[model samples]
Target: MVDRCSLEKEYILSPELKFKSEIQQLNNLPKAKKEFPRLSEVPSQVLQQTIKQLHKGWEYFQKRGFGAPRFKKFGQFKSLLFPQFQENPVTNLHVKLPKIGAIPINLHRPIPTGFMVKQVRILRKADKWYASISLQCDVSVPDPMPHGHPIGVDVGLEKFLATSDGVLVKPPKFFKQLQSKLKLLQRRLSRKKKRSKNYEKQRLQVARLHHKIDNTRKDFHYKQAHALCDAGDMVFMEDLDYRITAKGMFGKQMLDAAFGQFRSIVKYVCWKRGKFFSTVDAKGTSQQCPECGEEVKKDLSVRIHDCPHCKYKTDRDVAAGQNIRNRGIKLISTVGQMGKETACADELPGAGVIQSRQVSQPRQGKTRKPKK
Candidate 1:
């Protein structure tokens, strides 16, 4: 579809290549089935869903600046979505599909009450097949309010996370642990002929190892996120993009740390637990002193934070966390009017400065009438 649209202005164009409407695409499915008999094997809805998915990507490309829609190589498109169901397709032991019969599957946990199963997606990873079921509930939940102790977190390759409350967690290098074994498997795979039985077997082994590492890293992230929520009610983190860091010299370590995934998990866990989560400006977080508002410049090699002005010394990461915490507190006070509503006024490092500003600013009351 994209190719056809791109070449629409060309002098010589193929008569068979026409960018059809979605309805026209659906109508042509019968003709397509005649040409490719395998297409008739799957449910019509599933095939329609695939076409809709392609259109969605194209639409997104039109709206967003970059990222043009392209073809997926064989085995790249891994999942099949069943958008709607007239009956409950999942049970304790079996999940029924439209064309395929019931297949035995382990239920991770029973679906909660009052939630209806909206859709099911079947996906394959390594040698195992799995189904991801989507559930919907018509309920409104309020956002968690900012309250209690605030904790700032700093995540890096040195430490998985450092909290304002003086807790430090070391990163568990999941991929590095299995890299040697994975290399051995890949070397053996390279010796085998492509598409041969032994080659396929070796490929599965490599994929399974990668899958295991991903699972381990994800498990660790969740554990750390839950621990953070347990430590404080209000969680603050620096708003730094880890993607840029992933292209630097320590790219592998940055990717292995998976800070972005960890932050997302922390945010979700905070919301689930009714804890407030926020991100502060990342500029000069490590350079600024938490004790005093003076800048103490240091290179990346300097792990220790020694502030000459205030004689404040601590781990650089911990100091960053503390600065993040202070900034978060100040941010909440200014936005939420915590000085009048909460007892956080006395806790701010620059309490006098904040009080002066609060006194100078007028309350946001009703607008006054314009002079005639």
Candidate 2:
């Protein structure tokens, strides 16, 4: 009964306490019933109860190990989609387990009402206990804006995002903030003897540092992604190449930020609300000129793009964003023209994939806007 003011409780437990207690519970299983008078005297009721207890313990063991009940490397993934299994217990922080009793939720904000309460999941993030309670609610669609008001977003290290509106969101650079602490922890871990308790302790320290880094990076990505989603009538952003592209120093930092995750979440939520999202190509969008259609051979150091023939100069990222928008609109138009639903990735050589290096040959920027 989650009528806004339901059984909402949480608590932040120490890593040592949570780890030690769970490990002990999972490892300490009851002994088999020896000296049974008869199979009937053993009591089928008792046997069933004992089996249930063992089943719960087995689940915990499978998730964490028998020795130190810590999270698995890949973590536990549970979903209530079992075919024959009729019931599964809700993992709320406040929900009492058999014999172990309840673990309270330490909520930071007041729970809202008008939502049908669903099961709560208790998760251990770093050293804290968090209860994620999913509520059943039907949220409606928002008002629509007219066309010609769509947005395009270009992402990079210098600016986290460059929108079609010419707004540049700067990267938060979270790793830079905790550089000293990370360096200290890494150095200490290096100094510790291998396979020793001290080394294991240092490893935990490193893990905590990494967890902190992840949280900070995620926070920034959420703010930026959310803002972009809410602002746009139609969104167009680059589908970043997670592999080979994240090779350089800055690229590595961007990857750590989980750019793909951020974009995916934003896109998903928007799609649910009936909004459109388009992931444009990354190739020539950055290099091609948006104005007079010239290939400006600009280095990363050169922030301002100076088109030689057209004498057009603007911020490189801004120009890039314009190109992304233009390309996306053109691609969308072409798809609509064909009366078919297709993807830009499917855009092949003779298909929608734009080609030629005429901008560099001679007429570079001198030529007026080429036929779109």
Candidate 3:
């Protein structure tokens, strides 16, 4: 089993650095491209040799029909380009790098059970070196969740998530708290000359602060997922796209909370433990009453749900959770068992055990790759 724990700051830099690096590369491209005019004629060895900090570098190459911008680093790049790989991760995690030697890693979370660390990636984010350990586990996938208890989780912009149990997981406002300080750091960053020693030092400080907020968010997600798992054998919730979208840019609080990360962990852990994990329609989960099965008035400001038709009242999140649980029960049953209450838990051919509750993901979410 290969599991990826995206240390928050590490992820933050991967993209932010990528963006800044793009700007810098564009600035340098005219000169570099002119100098290496006949890049097509360059030898493969020359190509690799010209690339310093190759792993940290990203570029595109083309001659034939296929041309794609790609990362060309050693360890990090190799892991992405190739498939089968294994390496023992450094326990104390400090190994070696171009500039920084073995650095300290505060690995507070427990590593996956009974897996040998295959590789450790030393990356420079804004400041820190996080060890991403790929583990190979001996364990096999788990059986499905029993039908006795099903869960549904509703995700929203106003509320982090509403569970079938009438519970809510509030999105931690991590970044908002540090926004002022972060702004100061960022302002300080802009004041410094680009690539200067002071700029580099300040960048590291910003990276560390970002790391702290991310750490706090990650801890909260783990605790929530663990609690969710204990509530039922199967966990049900929408596979929500918590990322910023065209409609609006998602808030920093959403990113800091990392709801998608928690969902992913819940799915993997549930599968590992033979519990049912699934999702259903998210659009109207909250608008429809779980008790009466009727649409009701709901606003962004309202936390408690009160249905007029059925005289139903519950926390909005909890009501959504119940609806999810109900939907989950129906989803777990295959066609052959139609109308047969006893055969409700019958598993589909590829769905593992009869208790398998994994829902077929909708096409819309397919376009975007899930990131930690």
Candidate 4:
């Protein structure tokens, strides 16, 4: 259907018209016993749902400036949606669909008493079949942690997170640890003939390994995010631009760190728990001295921040955390009363203190004339 719709130039601009035309064509087909037997056997609602999905894809493309919809080949389409489903009358543990019979489901957790299942989507992954059931229920918000401090976190490639309270959290580099095994698997896969049974087996093995790595990373992120949200009432972090940073020399390391995922987890977890979460400009968080507001320029090799003006010294990451905390506090003080959703500024308070003090540059001159 997606392929047929894409071929029509007129349908490219209007998905609704294309959907209606497709439905009309399906309805006008011959009877099941005579011709188009399978088409007639399939439920009308299922066909309509597929057409609705195609239309939705085009709508998304128009609104989000995404690429046009494309045809799904053989195994590419892994999931099928049943918009309407009900509890099986014969079996308590199965769900009845329109055309499909009662399918048994493995309930990992008990569903809430008052919750109602709205839809079910069955998906295939590797050799496993999974069902995703959407439900409607009333959910109560969790209470925020009663006692905790406001913390500023600085996420870095070296350390996963450096907190304002002199704490550092390190990431478990799951991919790096399994790189050798993955490389060996890929090499073995490359040696097999394409489309051969051995090649397919090796491909599945490689995919499972990748999936394991992803799952491990997600597990770590979730645990760390939960810990941070539970320990802090308000959390502040740097608003980093990962895309721009990924084009640099340490692109691989930056991507591996997965700071963006961690930030997202923290943001959502905070929101769900009624904790305050904020992001501050990261421009001078590392360079600017937290105590005296002096700009101390240093390279990445400089792990410690030694401010010449105030004679204050600390770990570079710790200094950055402190600076982030100060800025967050200032932002809250300025905007908290106004009930603003976000606290943002072009520059942190006292950021230009050092720059404003202009010292005269010494030049070579005639010393004799000054003496006379």
The candidate scoring highest on lDDT is 1
The estimated TM-scores of all candidates read: 0.85, 0.58, 0.62, 0.72
lDDT: worst 10-residue window of model 2: 358-367
User: Which candidate achieves the best TM-score against the true structure?
Assistant: 1
Q: Write model 4 residue lDDT over 124-235, tens digit each, in one string.
A: 7765678877887788865543123456788887777777656676656778889899999999999999889999899889988887887778877877777766555667
Would you list the rank order by TM-score, best first?
A: 1, 4, 3, 2
Tens-digit lDDT track for model 3 on 261-311? 878877876776666787776667778887668898678688888999878
Off by over 4 Å in 2: 1-93, 96-100, 107-122, 132-148, 190-203, 248-251, 272-274, 334-372
- Candidate 1 differs from the real structure by a C-alpha RMSD in angstroms, to one decimal, of 10.5
Candidate 4 lDDT (Cα, 0 to 1): 0.69
Summarize candidate 2's per-residue lDDT along 85-136 as a digit string, tens digits: 1133333334433323455655555546565544444456655556565655
lDDT-better candidate, 1 vs 4: 1
Judged by lDDT against the true structure, how good is candidate 2?
0.59
Tell me the whole-model lDDT of each prediction, alpha carbons only: 0.81, 0.59, 0.58, 0.69
* Clashing residue pairs for model 2: 9-105, 10-104, 10-105, 10-106, 11-105, 11-106, 93-103
